[model samples]
Target: MNSISSRTFWVSLAVAFGVTLYVTSSVLAPFLIGVAIAYMLDPLCERLDRIGVPRWAAAGAVLFGFFSTLTAVSYFLIPFVWGQLVDLVKHLPEIRTALMSYLQPALDAGKPHISPMVIERVQEIANISTGTIVSGANKIVKGAVTGGLAVMDVSVIFVLSPIVGFYLLKDWPELSSFITDSLPRAYEKKILALARAIDQTLAAWLRGQMVLCLVLACFYMVALTLSGLKFSLLIGLLTGLCAFIPFVGFAIGLTAALVAAAFSFDTWTGWACVGFIFAIGQMLESYVLTPRLIGQSVGLHEVWVMFALMAGGAVLGFTGVLLAVPTAAILRVLLKSAYGSYLESDYYTK
Candidate 1:
């Protein structure tokens, strides 16, 4: 094909893929999750295969290990986390009352600085907000309906994702070979280089982040539990999961720990301990965990990562969030390559 025709064909293909993704995003979540799982486990499967295990057997073993971990979490961790969640929900009113007690004084003090008429108008609005309340109730009802459907979706994913991962892992080698063979001869070297770059960036980030998250979760769980905080496990798990969002996880986790400390202990000693634990965790993450693990392999700036996360979430919800980092990594590689090419081109040289 002529260069123009080739470029047009590629651009059209890209547009088609984008449209397909947009249309199927809702159903793609589980498959994407499975792809991630399979991607991570592919190396292990390969290692096993090299050691004389059949590819299918190696994939089966990995899947077995994955399920075992899930089963363990379901049995031991879920119950404790669920119990804490229920207790937290039950005491939310009390927590709110406690918060209001502290906040009310500040609000009251500020009220005197504002116009009396403004205060009166606000009070009147608050009193006549029944329609707002009804509207909120309707939203709650709608959310509940959405949640019911989400639960069904979750059920499907829970069953399907592992199976998807298993098959993907099993056939990964064949798939890779097929794809590599299908690439155009002239562009094969460039495409392979980009693919390898993507693989390195993605694999390093995902594996390192997983390890980092697990370590942080254990640390938080133990430290908070030792400090005698209520709902420690749940809070720790939340923090660990949110670790993907950079500083947000620590901020949220620290806030919860402080609240729990304040609620559970009257003295400043518990608060000090809580603060100390979090400070130490931060130090470990900053100085030890991140550098040793994720480092610069992600190849996206902190700001870029944050933007990618927000944009992904806004566009694709949870699935978008899951895809964001990898997408960003790939984009970074592509952008760098394109910029390098541009710098060498006649347009730049001129």
Candidate 2:
């Protein structure tokens, strides 16, 4: 129909999709995870199809191989990580005690600037916060009976996500064709251009982040384990995996690593070694890996990414958080296009 009506229809359609995501948030986790897997694997499947492999076989082979590797890694790594986690939980009191011993001087030094009540409350909390943290962690994992993630069932993610990914991968060509055919004829070129921009930005981010995560994980795991730290893999790998989130991931991972180091070592030399390792990680990520892999051309500033994630999490819960990056990237492209159009219009020239 008319431009105004078409715009209204698309906007309304977007809002409805968002509402549907929220309503089906529980189921959305596995489906979204599956969709993400499928999206990432689509390129490989396409390549296989072009090389004389049947599409169904290609999808099946890729899915099977990917999941097989994942399952194998999990099978071995999970037990070790779980064991470390158990030991770490058991020693939380000692870790807390050791932590407070180091921080007690800082707490005392802050007495003049900080209120006595606040300092006193902090010490009180420090005395028992470990148990609270452990309890909370326990509750979260206990919720795993449902089969997904926190609030969603954790176990279901393993079974459901891959299944969803497999089918999506198999039908991806048809899906892409359907979507392309449905675009409004008048605006199809513009829409396709926007889609391509978003695709490039998103693909760069997803692939780069995956590489960054793995590289960082390997670095941390090897370095920390070499230095004799406990749960090095869990800490390192998690830090690396979450590295896509910017500072928060590294900070959280570093904090845990430091705590574990503190508990594991007697001297400041050991702590210094651990600190050095992470410092190197931060420098490596900021200076080396990120620029080489993701680059600055994508317009994904750390601040914007963080803001999008936080806003998404606030507005739509976990599903929002999962979608935040791609959605923000798409919006960024659209906003850029809109701005260009606005600059070219008579309103700007007048």
Q: Write the per-residue lDDT of candidate 2 for residues 182-261, one digit (tens) a residue.
A: 98898899999999999999988988888999899889989999989987987988898889898998998889888888
Prediction 1 TM-score vs. true: 0.88
**Highest lDDT, which number?**
2
Off by over 4 Å in 2: 107-119, 128-131, 137-152
Clashing pairs in 2: 146-153, 147-153, 147-154, 147-155, 147-156, 148-153, 148-154
Tens digits of lDDT, candidate 1, 221-336: 98889888888998888888777677888998998887677567777898899899989998998899988998865676767888999999999888788889989989988998
Backbone clash count for every predicted candidate, in the order shown: 0, 7
Local error of candidate 1 at residue 61 (angstroms): 0.6
RMSD, candidate 2, Å: 2.7
